[model samples]
Target: MVPTMVLVADDSQDTDRKEALRDLADAVAERGEAPVVRAFGSGSEVRRAVHSVEGPMVVVPAFVAGGDFASAQLFAGLDLEGRFDACPTAPLGAVPSMVADLAGRLSASGWTDGDGVVLAADGSTGQDERQAVTDVARMLSRRLGSPVQVGYLNSWAPSVGDAVERLQRNGRERVAVAAWRLVEDRDYDRLHEMGAASVTAPLWPSEIVVDSLLAQHRAAKARLAA
Candidate 1:
């Protein structure tokens, strides 16, 4: 069966991360799937571009410093709530061991050696986030007997596009992006376009995750009462 095609739209015009996005696109193409990954510096451009395509497509916004407005506009333009199912979103702290365990699970579930990308947030410079990613990379490397690359959501840490570039530089054939914030359909679409698979921690915790869950629970109770 032909895999679904996806499009990635982000707002980073002149960054070096374009290489990573290209690597991701190549990975998807190699999967015998048709994924079209494209990046734009503005949500308006992406929105216009997507309308020209038919069938299902995913869009991912690059993590801008403090602008979710574009993301929100993208979501509205796409009517995401009506189009795709919402996956639970979670924020995770530095948990190297847990990440390693999750990597193992991904492997068991059919991720091939060096065919994975872990997306993490830019650890505050003095924080353990960076260390956690490094440790997990080491663990995954040992498990796969090959080096595993890490990507960051924001530009502060190594960007996801940058990590993808590094993997390409190392000649990795296929890659999957395991990230926390890629839960939205748009994000998933971005990964698909880049030719990278997307996965996240199941029990990872984050403010958004917690709030969404709680809201759901309350809604369920209200429905029951009604």
Candidate 2:
């Protein structure tokens, strides 16, 4: 087992978002049966946290819609190379388990057959990350036995409002949004305002999220062992 684990996230300037991430991290650590250190933001905090743990420590990127590539870029900016024994794992968005979670959330939010579904995420400028979001949306669509449109909170087209409007135009009376963000940010708030009949809570502090983290941790350990 890695002696220590760190749940890392890109710094959200909002305190509420930061607290949400911290709470999610704690939940993941508890459910994953490991003590996890919550590290947000860039610079000294990340550096110190990385240095505090030695020898192939597990690092979970608390980000959605971006995988290892995004993590690599963020860590590189933090100068995380050779600082400690760190094994970076895939971001939460890359996990297939999230599809199940989304399904459950949508269903719980009063989603029904024939209702339009939209997977909403904070849009990314990076093509790979945007594609990752689309991939997840497709996976969810498959599970729901319905097609799901992709919408962005920012930096992209086809906003959630646009999706709802499109679905409404097509005669779908009920529309629901499955949130892809871990915290309630501007995007999260915007989803509610977009006039979706229902919007899921942030995709964190849930059993599915914990399972995904464990899956990512196990995969990273296997890769290291191999």
Candidate 3:
């Protein structure tokens, strides 16, 4: 079977963005589906491609920092509902579902109870970003059947390392960290340096989730495949 193709749109040409998209593409491909990953350097480019793509395509926005509003507007401007199934960059409401999905992935990856923590940061300084983190943490905790704390790297609160230390000091056996922000090489290196494991949520690209966008993309993909 031919795998689904997902288009990744971002304004920056940075390495972090590229890696995140690749990770997502790999995840989709691992589902036994084909994926054609396309990167856009601007919203205009993304908008244009949205019209040109022939099949179902997941539009992943590269706006990780503070451009969510603009990204949201661009997605909205495309009137995706009229033409395609759009899955926006992030979908926090799907955190519970994502947590369930993560549980399986973590278990497969050798994660055990009380051994991992979900780490997320609101790098965009947007109110929704913080809420998204909290939502994912809550869902993960529920799904894991234990308390899973969330920490922000950019906040005044304890850093990722500090969070790990606290968990270790409290006698947690294995500790893993998950972030919603762009998983840059430095970020991954830092997680390794801190002795914490990390995983990124598939639904919340860049730690943000816009449900309408996700629905659109999913619908478009289904329509094309059908």
Each candidate structure's count of clashing pairs: 7, 0, 21
Model 3 per-residue lDDT tens digits across residues 108-134: 656677685755443344556556666
Sort order, lDDT high to low: 2, 3, 1
Best candidate (score: TM-score):
2
The alpha-carbon deviation from the true structure for residue 39 of candidate 3, after best TM-score superposition, in angstroms, is: 6.0
Clashing pairs in 1: 20-165, 24-194, 25-194, 28-195, 58-189, 59-186, 91-205
lDDT per residue as tens, model 2, 7-49: 7766645666677777888777666566688777665677677
Superposition-based RMSD of candidate 2 using all C-alpha atoms, in angstroms: 2.9
lDDT per residue for candidate 1 within 101-196, as digits (tens), equals: 556556654577647555433333323335545655666566666666666543354666677767766776666665433123343334444445
Off by over 4 Å in 2: 1-3, 42-44, 66-76
For candidate 2, give the lDDT.
0.73
lDDT of each: 0.44, 0.73, 0.53
TM-score of candidate 1 to 2 decimals = 0.39
- Residue 215 in model 1: lDDT: 37
